[model samples]
Target: MNDPIRGTARGSAPAPLSVLDTALAGRGVSAADALSGSIALAELAERRGFTRYWVTEHHSMPGVSSSSPAVLLARLTAHTTRLRLGAGGVMLPNHPPLIVAEQYGLLQALAPDRIDLGLGRAPGTNQATAAALRRGRSDDDFPQQVVELLRFLDDDFPEEHPYRERVYAVPGPGQDKENGLPQTTGRPSVWLLGSSGYSAQLAARLGLPFAFAAHFSPDHVAGALRLYRDRFTPSAVLTEPYALASFAVMAADDEHEALRQTRSYAHSMMRMLHGKSYLVPTADEAASYPYTASEQLVLDRWTNTVLHGTPDRVTVHLDRLHEAARPDEIMIASVGHTPQALLRSTELIADAYTLPSTPVPVSAR
Candidate 1:
């Protein structure tokens, strides 16, 4: 099947690539250093022809420092000139819709058309942190929250709506009083992020671009994308289904080095699975740690989900993934013990695909 968004048939070639950063902070790496690494990664991604650099939201994880995507994206705006900066994504259930609108509106003001607002319903954290962040708010109202958020972003609440004329999101869509024609200060591109069929249906109904969380929920990727495309309805924002799949990828100079990095990342995942703090261990630490029978089973399962090997090996797997899912774009979430490892993976993947060294203009994207 042909994908209108990319103007290509499935499996013909890889689609546009992007980055999904977690700002890993562990193995003696400070939070500040992790953030700096993210900035450097963003700069390199832009130069390597990646279209977007998106930061994911996670809280109470000792190894992750990208808890506030909007704040981190604000910093990213100052570092890169052409790359699209976005939250991949902000957990909308954790904040008021108006607040989300205002925050992203501010980003648009800073970077204009380069800002993207991807929203998710998940808390992006454990139960206790979710409770603290939500303050007893119900997550069942996610659909309605999206509606209200869109109104604020477009600044187009109907006349009968209570928020119309009573409240406003500054730096958002508005009308010119003199001519009465509507005007907007560059509204950011809005995308719906999901890991299940529910979010896929919602994104379809809302006519927004959809991004599947394939990095973690690999089992649900195909079903979610199928539901998204099958039910998609056209809207002003999107005329056709646009779907992106995010994968956890790690590439290295050799298969052995990649496996070493994978083990380090898997050790962190195992700790989180066992309810321990998600502080990533160094490769040597992972190699030396004694693993019980059950832990080895768990590590083997998690390791299978991560695409890791030499650049050629990883690229082959990515191609197979593209052939099966046919996503309009692929977003990479690289994992490693150090910033240099992640950077090297990114450089290798870009070179393997022969990605341009020049920036892809906003219009072209």
Candidate 2:
């Protein structure tokens, strides 16, 4: 069998659950300094041997300040000696092609092999925020935007390319590795992110890596994964069905502490969804809050999708999920009030859920 996704990656496997710390700024840190510290988290992930460090983009988000992934990633590259630093997703619908191309291109220049450019078609915000980002695009323009972005980043466009003059990923492609480090081959690896069958179909058809947003969109995980694998075709980006499944995780020495942390997250989510004081409360503060039936309902919905509890407890569910999805990599998303707590979670997962020492037999292997 011709292996699928061969030479695609060193850490792209399903067993080890990779950790993704999005909304790092939401840990109640000052926006200005939070990004720097978030980069520190990325460094820690590398030290802990995580697969990657991805920051998300969101405009006008109170709890998070990662509104510009390119900018933050640049800062991160300067601080982190290792770790593949990239966007958990740069929402394609929110921006135009050249802007993203040039920005991430610059990032690749700074840290070549250590980059990935995952794109999500979702606005990642409400309609109000979407309108604020760009007022002209229609619903159909979303996929076009993604196609345009890939064309720009891959540097495959010709001089006659319609957007070439207006677009450039400057100081192009000189990034290289000195030691056993990761380097972008000028253009970063691209992945399609989604929570629905639509994205699944798109990823499969394009033969690109697929990452399901099961961290928050658990309701559709199994279905979406099925669609992605079933409809998969071989393309330049990928030769067969390769996936990176994600789920929220919280680990601690004790199960009670894990649940306590989840309660805080649930409470904060309620504040975000409803009109309430919005803050990413500490576990202590969350444990103190009085959750209502409304909040409980919200918690239940997320719990179905989120992987919570101690490593032992969480692994059982994650293992079941891995068997079902058979992802190339599994990313665990987490955030906490203190950076120490966040780092601890990263270390815990790395120690407990990493892939087997010997590589599994990949389709392309």
Candidate 3:
């Protein structure tokens, strides 16, 4: 089949996917301001021919402030004309299914064809924080919640079923009789997000698309895809596995700049490990972090999968990733010590991957 990604000859190619994330310019800017900035950036990505602009959800975060993805997505959706807008993921364990349905349905109502919801099981924070957000819900029951959410979105429960009689998503877009679920006047599309085997298999069994969080999960990238593809049994939505791999793409004018910029992520990762994940700092501020020797080594290891270097250099690695994973789409997450640095990374990545004269016509979004 022809790979929609590049319109090129295909022996084992996946279709081109939409690109970019909503947390475009990292840094401690307020969510409102960041959204405003990202709106312009998304416009740039669209004009540059990138695919999607996915915002992520994180709560009680100081450095990063992407708390309400649905609300932010709606705002960003209003600003951009085309680049598909979505959530890199909303943590399922944190919110009720109906709430998710209602919020996204509202967004879908506003931006019909351009809404997407990628769900992850992680709290995106510490246990205490997750506990606070979840009230009394069981994180152990995430799988069940995922299923329930899917059924709600599909609104596929037959009326004859007793459960269907007493239970229904009041705010569900309604079922598209054809889909046996609530009818969608065209709200957000759903995607399962993962970092390992469990999510991959779940996505397969559910017959929904999957997005792997390769940004901080380089080691499991190939393995997760392997499970996803191996266990996949075609379903109604997809005949084969449709995998999207997210990565930290930090491209700059030079290797040194890229490496230095990556310190932001390293620091953030450290904070996460210790319960203080914050938005990336300014380059000047980042230089001031007193990382211990051991901490530096850990981050270096964690940064293994991150693509850092000039566009040409980064493209070489990206091509290798494509060869190995053959993802339908590649979502680039360029978080740097400063907003300007992050914007530069995104620009350079766009340049490296979007060249009309590049010899390799690979376009995995």
Candidate 4:
């Protein structure tokens, strides 16, 4: 298929498309359904040629059910073969480095080359919850924690290191070879997820891939990416920098419907900003809710940051963003309240980009 807006072949489209998902639970969706929807969407993403599927972590958030990204991603492996599945990030501060390494290590063992372990510095919840999850641990130690986690993943502790030979992530590096297990299931690729320069710089120093969270923090996208490329240092994981930009995008066959969906997301975001219950409102609810002048301004600002419209319009905007930032990949974080809307938006965007859908072989399935 060809790009609808540019009338060019799919290969010419800006960059490879991937997915960033938060198993949203709100309005007509139950928590179980949200998880199930993620599975279905990942399967579709693989068939539609999306590069990878990354689920983010959120804790005790009313409208978010993706509290455990590793668990959700585990389920996805059974449903898809080609799709690269990962935690958009596991909030490192909330759990011990060894635990996080073990979880992802086991995942790598299960999914082989298809797993990714994206790390983030921030706690994905409020202060109270962060305290509860972290106990007395300090978030300021994030960089150190990342190094420790990587060591566990690689099973490469120096002789002088305290944990060398004393600790290990069982399913991690050398496990398969030592135990005579299949070597096909290698370790997960690492990526740093961020909305600022700190994360970009850390990723650069370590020579890991960097994925900017433009979906939430649009203002820093260009600057953060620039810092990453400028300060990059070659390492074993990467010889050069690889950057991925994620954006909140929704595409529909009809422009009006797309607008309504975006408005619904705006209302939900407004509620979140105000520290309200954070349930996603339906499009009809959003359309009928009376907004104060200030609230309307907030809504407008949020909507402007997102790319929403017909498939052609959205793809055009995506191409422009790619040209400006020059990310190696473009990841779409669909912001629709309902599962069906999310699926439809994904399908429309794939069609617009003419992404080839390779059917899964029966044996693989």
Candidate 5:
């Protein structure tokens, strides 16, 4: 029997690509520098005609600076005009649903149509950090939290709901008024992000778009997508199932250099696995680090999930991934030892795929 997943040949039309930045600090770089790098990359992505520019949320990590996506997005809005800014995502379990809605609602008010709210159940941090962030709250009720979040966003609470009359999401959905009530002027588009079938099922059941974190957790990509499509139901937000598959990618002029840049990511992962701070190391440092056979195996497994090569080779790899997953959109999570290399990788991929260079109109923004 043939494999369930299909494969696309080289030179095929590429799917829409977007960028997912973690604001990873390079060796000897400060978090401020990393954030500046993220803004520069978003500007580049906008110029390259990429679909969206998403920043992730992480806590207490020396190498990552995107601790608060909403705050970062607020800064990003001043630097970018047309690129869609979003949290790739905010760990919903870490925050109250009302606050999440209010924050994203304010974002929408700031940039209007160019805002997205990607919600995830994961703490986006380690267990100890998760505990500190949660502060005695239970994350076991994720489904209920999601429902409540949606209700807050839509201002759709029932008449008898206790909070319905007591609270309201400011700058509500749109400019529609009734009985002299101030109409809601903005609401960010929401998406469910996950690396497992549970999130897929939830997104499908709720009719929200789903984004799978194949970049780090490759094992569940196929299963999650399958479950999502198989069980999807239409909702007011989405008429049909829409899924985005995020992949770790690095492309360069030379295949060897591209592969070398990935060594830093490998070292970072190894550190994370060993319960060490995941500060990105230099390529030379990563190369010189001694590893046991078992540790080497772990590194190899983690690195295998990333696509790294010359632009031509990387393009072919992306094509195959698109064919197999059949996601509506493809999101690239690019990392490197240097800011220049990371920006160059994105540029090379955009050129390889012949992505448009036109910016979204200011009128649209």
Candidate 6:
């Protein structure tokens, strides 16, 4: 097989690649099994030289098992070594800043430098679930909440600040000496995730790393990148702008087989668009579904977001995306009919990119 991803970017260094798993439930597979699959995939990604293994947050979705990224990441920490595990991300609007800070602070305390907290303003579920999660709170406070969360994480609140003395982000920056707990130095690497210019500008102004969700929302990628770059300023977290763009990909040994794997993903998205249960259908089931002309148009648009082909062909498409987006890293979101197929697609892409495999360290668990 010809390696299409062999060369470096056009006049630039080869960008790092990472994996984003949503733990999509397959046909006849239980949610527990899907989560196990995610763990297996993360283990594979670590051995395959992938930079990071990120799990997504989605609530009330029967197809996705990753409703709580923090909880899942805690489990993943004991299962794999050398792979940066994180929420990619935790929706900020769904929880209070203090709670988010403390949870991730504990995670960092456990894993040290291997934890990342990618924050997003969007709710990770449907309207009903969002209401339940937020209780009656408005999302208008997102920017302020972000600032508060960062302050708590860094323990940078000034003496005059109202919450400075009253609230300490326990197990975080300011630990109580009376409790006899050793002061922790672990701090999570924070990244802002978004699909629009609003988050791009905020992330830039805050000087944090940014990850754009171009895998689903491709319309605003270029503009968001430009805005982030133009508005970025040096901060405590970063000296320069670093951006990662995610894309849905499914590579296989043959073009026909690759396209076949994507049918389930397309059908899943179509079901979501129509407010139906978003369970991932089998490829055979997806193919058998009747489609109206309008529905076919929707499916075509949804499936177009996915890069499905043989490894060589997929690599070329990824390279073009890299050239156009100029992101510092490219994150792959691969979904398939079966666990083996998904694993194979990820392996093929990693191999095409010439990623060096590393020996998995003994499980810390």
TM for every model, in the order presented, reads: 0.93, 0.83, 0.85, 0.94, 0.92, 0.93
RMSD of each: 3.7, 6.5, 5.4, 4.0, 5.2, 4.5
Using lDDT as the yardstick, the better of models 2 and 4 is 4
Q: Considering summed lDDT, which 10 consecutive residues are worst modelled in model 1?
A: 1-10
The residue-by-residue lDDT of candidate 6 on 1-365, one tens digit each, is: 11111112221225878889998787887888888888889888878777788899998887788998988888888887777788899999898889999999888778777888899988887888889999988678888889999998877789899987678787786774435566555578888999888889999999989999998887677788989999999997688898998989899999888877897888888888888877787888888899999778888887888999998778788888888888888888987777667788988888887777778876643
For model 2, residues 1-365, the per-residue Cα lDDT tens digits are: 11222222233234544556654545456776566567656766655556677887776656677788888888777766545777879888777777777787778778867778888877766667778887866447767777877876765566787755554455443222323345344577788888888889988888888888887777678888888989999987666677877888777778777776666666666776875544567777776767788887885665445567777677777778878766667787765555555666666666565532332223211
Task: Give residue 167's error in model 3 in angstroms.
Answer: 5.7
lDDT of 3 by residue, 57-108 (tens): 7766665656777777777665665557778788988999877877776776
lDDT of 4 by residue, 177-260 (tens): 567665545567888889989999999999889999998898789899999999999998688888999999889888889988
Task: Say which candidate scores most in TM-score.
Answer: 4
Give the whole-model CA lDDT for all candidates, comma-separated.
0.85, 0.68, 0.69, 0.83, 0.81, 0.82
> Who wins the lDDT comparison?
1
- Which digits, one per residue and each the tens of the lDDT, describe model 5 over residues 1-365? 11111112212346667889998786887878888888889888777777788999998787788899999899888877767789999899999998998898888888877888898988888889999999987678988998998888788889899977567766565224433666545467789999988889999999888999999787678788989999999987678888888999888789788877887888788888888887788888888889999778877877788899998888798888887878878889987777778889998888888766766455533
Better of 2 and 5 by TM-score: 5
Ranking by lDDT: 1, 4, 6, 5, 3, 2
Q: Which pairs of residues collide in model 2?
A: 3-363, 3-364, 4-363, 4-364, 13-328, 18-332, 112-183, 112-184, 113-183, 113-184
Point out the higher-scoring one by lDDT: 3 or 5.
5
Clashes of each: 0, 10, 17, 0, 1, 0
Which of the two candidates, 1 or 2, achieves a greater TM-score against the reference? 1
Clashes of 4: 0
TM-score of 4: 0.94
User: Whole-model lDDT for model 2 versus the true structure?
Assistant: 0.68
lDDT of 2 at 56: 79
- Measured by TM-score, how close is model 6 to the native structure? 0.93
